[model samples]
Target chain A: MSVSVSANEVADAPQEARERTILGLTADAWLRILMPLAIGVIALGGWEWAVRANGVPSYILPGPIEVGQTLVRDWHTLSISLWITLQITFAALFVAALLGLALAVLFAQSRVIELSLFPYAVILQVTPVVAIAPLIIIWVDDIRIALLICAWIVAFFPILSNTTLGLNSADHNLQDLFRLYRASRWQVLMRLRLPTAMPYFLGGLRISGGLALIGAIVAEFVAGTGGRASGLAYRILESGYNLQIPRMFAALVLISLTGIAIFLAMTLVSHLALRHWHESAMKERR
Target chain B: MLAGVKAGPPVVTLDGVVKRYANGTLAVQGVDMAIGQGDFVSLLGPSGCGKSTVLRMVAGLIAPTAGRIGMAAGGEATGDVGFVFQEPTLMPWSNTLKNVMLPLRLAGMNRGEAADRAAAALAEVGLKGFEKAYPRALSGGMKMRVSIARALVTKPRLLLMDEPFAALDEITRHRLNNDLLTLWQAERFTAIFVTHSVFESVYLSRRIVVMAARPGRVVEDIEVNAAYPRGEVFRTSAEYAAHCREVSDALHRAMGE
Candidate 1:
């Protein structure tokens, strides 16, 4: 009887183990998603309760519900501002990527150019965009161009430095192999150096994406332009001046969401490009 | 002591070849070697013996400081040579097919022909279905196979390998060694292999050039009289053992010198 029982248990063991693994995987995945959501809900609930219990005025401390309601109510005006902010951010990011890549390639090709110019790039990065925006606006005479310059300066350095490092980091042996093949200078740059620099470029791009948004917002705050072309930062400022704290909170949420969206998009692009080869994007295998 | 098994006209000839680095180190000195066409030769030595330096000089990667190194076909500047480094040295961003295709592509061969030649080379290295796989997805042995495919894709006149299998495990190394010999026989390319392994040198080369360090120079040369298609039978046979013992003793004496 004991033998029969043990045999039956053995017969059932694989099926039981397989089912448990399937169940465990889903459970782990769900926990990963739901845990953060639960914390957010609890924190919002606590915030709402505190506001109500303390009887804080809407202009002073709008509750989460009021902010959401104001987000919906002020969607028309707020969205236009959001769009304007996005335009500046993306434009700056695009220009930064183009110029940064070109400059990196140039720097990789010549040590003299890099040694002469890299310090200026560093100086531009170190100087606060806020401190320079006023002078740029005054000198440029166009608020948009001035804002772009500010954002570009803020977003350019990482891509330049990262890509330069990556280009220089090609395997010494592989370089020798290329030399053995009598590869041309252009071929070496395109086939070896550029591909080697891709992961580092993408990493810098992710960081630059967030900085671009921050730059645009800060530039708008400094510009203080108060028209239809105003950005989310200006809306926040306007709402603050008008004591519309809920609307101000709504605009702040939009900016944060935009920043999050840009980061996620960059991360997705990096994953798609590098998933096959790069360690950073590859999935862990058992 | 330079007894080489002549196969044909000399493919590469090194006469009093010397290499002194910028930091005042004499890496190789007064090395004279004449590798016959289609011959398999191993530069066998201990570490710091500048075996790699000799190989690099042959490949024209670094110039000899004091002597003449000649290629029969002017192979150095014309991309008529292939080299395998100690590492697999594959571009991680590229797949096996692309990596193997690099030399042909760099030579301005059109895409389709390069692809076909690369695929054939990959098949020759026993990596037929792994063409689409990246280097990261490959095992160390497989990566080395891909590296060999890349080196041979150009169908160069001379193939130079510097300790290419030293990083692999003994089993993989033995397997690759056998595969390499087969490739060399089939391709009929003059091969110059650099290694510190006496057993490996005996197993792979028709001739072994033993070298010593501290102003590195050749100390002894031994000819292996074994026949072609050397395998496990040859590896365990008394003749192979004797050749290995002879090479090992030569290496020991070279080290002492």
Candidate 2:
């Protein structure tokens, strides 16, 4: 009787999961891609209608068409600002990864070092970057370096904590096997601890990517009136001063898109790295 | 080679070994035994019988609280000791071949030679075509085979197994038992296996040491006079059932005590 019940379940499971598709895409897949886009279009259409009907001025809330026209007209200026912001974000993220990984390894080796220094990292994370931007800019002659420092500060802690946890989480039995074989310290770290830490490090990377972008933009906002060469935040400030609100909206749109792209790239990297072995990343079998 | 006529001296000896945890619990007490080279011995008991504790002591993984635990100088000089835990306990990131090569690599052997030996070990465990498969992709039985291959890759003279097949189903357990006997005959390594199953111990070991719980210690030792290369025919024979009954009865009596 149990055998026949299991057979019935086995036969029925795939039919329910085999959802129909529109064109080449499954129903669920197409809905996921199209639903967000449809909502965005309808919301914008409503805003445009309401603005024209009520004769609301562009200074208050620019319609979607005006924002689009401003984006195309100011493409050169806006694209340059976008590139500058992205450059700082990527630089800060790279430095954070290298420093966080090195410090985590050191901490794994010695409790004394971790205990003495880890509190400072926590303090840096809790204190807002805006509060320290002016002091950093005054100390550092190069505005780019100041921006990178602020971004690196925001992005370094997650990688440190997560990688430390992963390193310490190596299976106890495997460690015993290594001891039985008389493995060297370097061998145990490279073969067991590092691989155990990869998935966690990637998780931290995804979060740090977004945080780095936020740091760069916030620092740029603080340095807007003082620095000569600046990022998109400076453009927003300039547009607000001149009451070119449409151009400000266009700059905001570009910034959001860039943040989304960074996040998606990090997600792709994490998926590729852990897809084979880690349970968190493996694909579910039916 | 001479059908188990005391092939060599005792490879490992425990003289009144005692283990008391830091939390003030006495896990094992006053256990004394000697295992000869190439002999198959089973430490059989119920749960909390400290069978696994004894196995761990033999592997030199934990210190005995009192008395002397000694290894033959010949075996210690070669540094060849293999261990298989209840779980497979493999590194998830590495493939089967790399996992098997870990011990040799730690011993300062170069990658080329280690890879050759690792592949040979995988073949010996019937995992030849799966050298590149990751641990997550393999089934439970296959993963256990890889763990066994890793343990055997260094040609260890002493192998300590702690209920290695306890998690497997009955069919797979029987097949692995047969395969393990083959490996034992071919390699002639001293095996000290820990198990809670009476029939399993009687079928697998030449001598079964029955243990009791509540401050665990050995109570009895029963010898199986079965011949070498015992197979399915013996498993179905009356003699095998009689041996199993005897061991089971001993185990029941120990538990009652």
The top-ranked prediction according to TM-score is: 1
Candidate with top lDDT is: 1
Docking class of 2: acceptable
Candidate 2 residue B205 C-alpha distance from true site, Å: 0.4
Look at candidate 1 and tell me the lDDT of residue B96.
Answer: 92
lDDT of 2 by residue, A4-93 (tens): 111222232222135566898877778888999999999999999999999999999999999999999999889988899999999999
Candidate 1, residues A72-172: lDDT per residue as tens digits?
99999999999889989999999999999999999999999999999999999999999999899889988888888889999999999999999998989
lDDT of 1 at B95: 93
What's the CA error at residue B99 for candidate 1, in Å? 0.8
Q: Give the runs in model 2 whose Cα sits over 4 Å from its true position.
A: A1-27, A225-228, B1-7, B77-79
Candidate 2 chain B worst ten-residue window by lDDT: B1-10
Runs in model 1 lying further than 4 Å from the true structure: A1-29, B1-6
Model 1, span B1-257: residue lDDT tens: 12334578998999999999999999998999898998999999889999999998888788899999988966654557888889999998889999999999998989999999999888888877778978886777778888888988888889999999999878778878988987887788899999988899999999899999998999988889888878899999999989988888888888783
What is the C-alpha local distance difference test score of candidate 2?
Answer: 0.86
